[model samples]
Target chain A: MRISDKYRYLGIKLTPQRLAILSYLDGNRSHPSAEDIYRSVRKEFPTMSVSTVYNTLDVLKEKGDVQELTIDPRKKRYGPVNTPHNHLMCNKCRHIVDINKEFKFTLPSSMTEGFELTGNHVEFFGFCSNCRKKQ
Target chain B: MRISDKYRYLGIKLTPQRLAILSYLDGNRSHPSAEDIYRSVRKEFPTMSVSTVYNTLDVLKEKGDVQELTIDPRKKRYGPVNTPHNHLMCNKCRHIVDINKEFKFTLPSSMTEGFELTGNHVEFFGFCSNCRKKQ
Candidate 1:
């Protein structure tokens, strides 16, 4: 979908700052942090603040248009893909890539006996190709 | 298991400090942070540092005797139970409780398409009883 349409679909007020963010995130595969997004967006809007970047990201996340990843411990990463998917994280260089494969595993009845299951996320951690080359 | 026996079984050398930590985590379910552990242990050992608490927790985690949780954003929480389980986090009060239930859900093949799935975790977010009462 077009960036303009995404903003309209999310019912978000289309400000210049927000449009820049949406444009940057559209089809962006590299999971970027709020700081990373702020620095990149500031290239055009030199006066953009980190807080604004975070606020915009939070708004986008709440709208279910973007996903926040906790794969990294230092800072939260944001992904443009809103679909259910898994992540591949390189432990050496902290690089994150999307795995487009489907997983099939039934949780044994012994694992979820009482509480209601809301959601599930699968994460694969290992050395990526670049990091493997370094070693 | 007894604290002394746990250390011996894990092949970990037991020091007075280490024993204190083990005793504290033997069956702990509160999901305490490093700071919380350090503070609690400090009542007995006045000089216990935060770094020691973190180091001990890291070693314990590596040995598979404790599990570290990313449910909290500010700090990592550790659980004493090594069994597979899910967590219930109260968004309002930040309280974490364990749900000793088994979950049964086959991940649709569309969810894990290209990558090897090594592990999975289920996290449920909601207001706990106390937090619900507050609202």
Candidate 2:
């Protein structure tokens, strides 16, 4: 998708760096961190700073256009918002696989005893087929 | 529990600073971060360092004696491992409440198509009762 058009839809500023960041994230399932995005986008814009990538990501996250995943506690990973889904992280390789299927869960009364319900995310940790084969 | 005894169970070194950290973490449900623990433990052991807190947490985490939570994207929170459960974070107050109940969720075949599932966690984000009342 065109960067300017994406900015219009996301109601964000159309900066060259922001466009590059968004373009890199568009349909990206790798769930990259700020450093990952910075390294990839730097190939095109050598002058772009890591902070720019982080700032753009922060804006995208605040706008709900990008999802920040915590599957890996060491660093925050970003995923595209094209589809709403959970994630499965391979323990061996640390590769995050998108779980596109939605699972209905009836929260036990004890779990939601005193709070209003909002949004919930399920993170599954496992070994991918390739990783399992190595094991 | 006695710090030395706790260390014995955890198979960790029984140092004074380690004792202080373990004492602070024992039965702690607030899920404090490394900075939080450092500030609290530093009061008793004025010579304690932030690196000590992080190192101790890392050791405890590796041993499965503590659970590291990523409910907050900014920092890693530590919780006692007395029980296994999910978490609910209050968006307004940024308070993390423990949901001590097992939830049964059946992942659709497509979600686990190429992965060998190990475990999963449900992170619920919303406003707590107090926050909801204020809102």
Output the number of the TM-score-best candidate: 2
lDDT for position B20 in model 2 = 78
Every candidate's DockQ is: 0.17, 0.37
Candidate 2 wrong stretches, greater than 4 Å: A1-11, A14-16, A82-102, A106-120, A124-135, B1-11, B14-16, B82-120, B125-135
Global fold similarity of model 1 (TM-score): 0.64
**CAPRI rating of model 1:** incorrect
Q: For residue A131, what is the lDDT in candidate 2?
A: 69
Worst 10 residues of 1 chain A by lDDT: A111-120
TM-score of chain A in every predicted structure: 0.64, 0.64
Residue-wise lDDT of candidate 1 within A18-134, one digit each (tens)? 778878987886778888899999999999999999888766654445666655667787777444445655544546666665444434445433322323445554445454443
Residue-level lDDT tens digits of model 1 in B18-95: 768877876786777888889989999999888888888766554445566566756777666444446555444446
Interface Cα RMSD, each model: 6.6, 5.0
